[model samples]
Target: MDNEKVRLQLYMARCGVASRRKCEEIISQGRVSVNGSVVIQPGTKVDDDDRVTMDGRLIKPTRKNIYIALHKPSKFLCSNEDPDGRSLAIDLISPVIKQRLFNVGRLDYLTSGLIFFTNDGDFAKKMTHPSSHVEKEYVVTTKKEIPEELMENFKKGIYVGGEFFKMKSYKLNGTNSVNIVLEEGKNRELRKVFQSQNINVKKVHRIRIGNVKLTGINSGHFRHLSEREIKSLLRDSSSKNGKYNNKGNRHNIK
Candidate 1:
């Protein structure tokens, strides 16, 4: 129907460009055009007949949404393109999947862990949003003896380089190893916190995200998420600790 118009950001997200929020950023930067005119407003309406182009290439909504969990190896980038020719994490799954997909959140280049790639923008936004309180578990190994105050300070909230960092939970596995859970999963978070105390981190491996576990997957391997698993993840975002909360804001998909 010609009357079935949708927001530009939502339209772009449906096309597998990125999350709706990211599409808004891209739109604001005037990277999207509607019917041959640049449209910077994210709220601009468009229908099936309207021509939409991103970076001068026409794009349409993806018919299928794919969600996959990947066991990303260390030293691989979580980006679509890198000017320096560094290895991209997406390349590992691209040849097999053959679809336009983007990472849900991010893992630093040198950090190895479980990461998700999908064309569902709403899922990406929900997983990454702060209020969702999705827990990510990582196992960290340090070169030196673990600091006694490290866990306490991080749990209580520590400031490094003027940025506040905190852990949802922490458990010491051994003298030099510990398991940490983070709700925010800030960029290079563990490294920065450890570096603040002059502690050298040997390895940082992410093992879990929400209800999803990386137990059976080997490094560089990927698997499609089961329908139940996808529903569980979405459920996790809406509830915490067996209680439902309405504190999180959500974007509507037209």
Candidate 2:
């Protein structure tokens, strides 16, 4: 093993298993094992040759990273497995994807539209990092007409779950519909934003991520992103290799 080591949870998080926090929970439950022995410590260090498994499934270092964009439909989980047997978005993909892939972020059970899946944990981490400033565009439909002050409040920022979560931009698409851009992907953020105002969010469909958008892809379908799209996203996320530079992740894909 090298002198520098990565935490087990962090490695799993990077492998697209789950978030560091969630991976810790998975560890505590004794679902993780290394070197043919059951291990439950999140801080355990692993080497390049170590064989790590979760629930008896080998999780290898992502050899050839798979990046995909799924036009998720409602009533599906962003997870690889569902104890309740509900549909998983990954199941919608071909079993041929063999690699232990996972959703980059989440879309919950109801919200739908553009969601991402990847085997590259570093890319997932970089994309979700708060510093990435990735822009998430959504189309929301409310149960009722929105108030006039909603835009102003969103523009000025609103206090949600302790921090100020603001909308980078929003457009009124209809009396009960809006297209909003967000820099952060907080849990059920759109719902929370409107819920705090006593407004009911009926539907939320993510339209775009970075420069990639859902075009001509039908619901419940997915497609591998082009190498160009991947580079653009990485570039837009940050100057990973100094190819592109931007002030904030708040900028949209042009």
Task: Identify the candidate with maximal TM-score.
Answer: 1
List the pairs of residues colliding in candidate 2.
Answer: 14-121, 133-249
Model 2 lDDT per residue over 211-245, tens place: 89998779988899999999999887776323224
Error of 1 at 151 (Å): 0.4
For residues 1-254, what per-residue lDDT tens digits would candidate 1 score against the true structure?
24479999988888889999999999999999999999999999998889999999999888899999999999999999999999999999999998799999999998998999999888898898776778899999999989768898998888899888889889998799999999877789899999999999999999999899998989999999999999999998867523424434332100
What's each prediction's TM-score? Answer: 0.92, 0.81
Q: For each of the candidates, give the backbone clash count.
A: 0, 2
lDDT scores of the candidates, listed in order: 0.89, 0.80
Worst 10 residues of 2 by lDDT: 245-254
